[model samples]
Target: MAEFSNSNTVIVAAGENLPLTETAVKAPACIVHREGSGLVTLRGLTSGQCRARFKVSFGGNIAIPTGGTVGPISVALAVGGEPLTSATAIVTPAAVENYFNVFVAAFIEVPRGCCVTVAVKNTSTQAVSIANSNLIVERVA
Candidate 1:
């Protein structure tokens, strides 16, 4: 079995989409973290079934306009730029004591040297703050 994991506590701005990189998250030895990129290189593996998991903890502060709406925070898993799965949650106003969390899990066929990435996106008009996030990948064959 092969496995890799990373975590981030940095704040992600509103309306921003970022790929979680290995350098930024400091993944363990089984996974090679790319510098300045969201992709994590899976090493010592061949074509097989792999499972990926993404989790994001985020919140924001904004006064919704009379007829405006807040947003749905989203987290996604992708392999070589192709989206495998995604999870989304509604974010409530900061004053309302609402914090949003999203988790996504996907099973995909990963070829040797394939790149796996986890991404977070804030679709709200107001800036949303991310408290922390985590990603885990495991080879199950």
Candidate 2:
């Protein structure tokens, strides 16, 4: 695995303000998963310190961490988009006004013709939004 910094520069919706209840960080269509056996990692950040909630869905079996980091870490799992399991992570403190990273790491085991997806929820009562993030997929045999 390559080492990476948990820095994020998100371009949130223009008209929206901070302290959002929950927002979706829509991924590019090209980044979707395909049938295979490997690991998929999603990394992102919030504008401020908040609790991040994540969900991962796979047609087969996948193992993921239940807890994440404020700057960058992996998300947990969910059936579709709703969290099948819950996890929490903190972001940069509100005073700093810095973007915090969120990540979802999974070791996927697929039978055949299966797929996976990752989604996130800003669990902070103060409302949070994502601007931009990156997805890294590593194949392991």
Candidate 3:
């Protein structure tokens, strides 16, 4: 007999500060695992701090319940490759000087072979661009 195992995270892209309303904007599928540990790190470079908007939404048209740690969303901002935070809000790609850091922790339960969509938006009026962003998923031994 053979044991079974699986896990993965798809890289999503947002072009030219645009809203992802097209079929091409669909994010890759994430494998579902009964148990595992993982983390996702998003890094985008810009001229200054911009209020970067990001969301971890359910794959496809399926809607997940809100107000739960699972599938929760987060945002982080950095300036000159350094971190900065305000009393109430952290800096973001939208807020150049305030670069914010947001983490959702291990709060989501992804079904095997299923993918979660992570969308990042630049809400600032200034011209800002996304440099690099990546996601990772791992299975614990």
Question: Model 1 has how many clashing residue pairs?
Answer: 0
How many pairs in model 2 have backbone atoms within 3 A of each other, for residues 3 or more apart or on separate chains, i.e. clashes? Answer: 11
Predictions in order: lDDT? 0.44, 0.31, 0.24
- Index of the highest-lDDT prediction: 1
Instruction: Report the error of model 3 at residue 67, Å.
Output: 36
**Candidate 2 wrongly placed segments (more than 4 Å):** 1-79, 84-88, 102-104
What alpha-carbon RMSD in Å does predicted model 2 have with respect to the real structure? Answer: 14.9
Q: Provide the TM-score for each candidate, comma-separated.
A: 0.50, 0.36, 0.23
Candidates' RMSD to native: 6.4, 14.9, 18.2
Model 2 scores a C-alpha lDDT of 0.31
Ranking by TM-score: 1, 2, 3
User: Residue by residue across 33-123, what tens digits does model 1's lDDT show?
Assistant: 5443455555435435343332223222222332334544443454554444444444455342245555556554445554444434545
Worst 10 residues of 3 by lDDT: 1-10
Give the per-residue lDDT of model 2 (tens digit) for 1-141. 221111233222222221112113333322243222123333322234232222333211111112322332222332234343433344453332344445555443332334444333333333334433333333332
Model 1 regions more than 4 Å off = 1-9, 13-30, 35-37, 47-69, 85-97, 113-127
TM-score of 2: 0.36
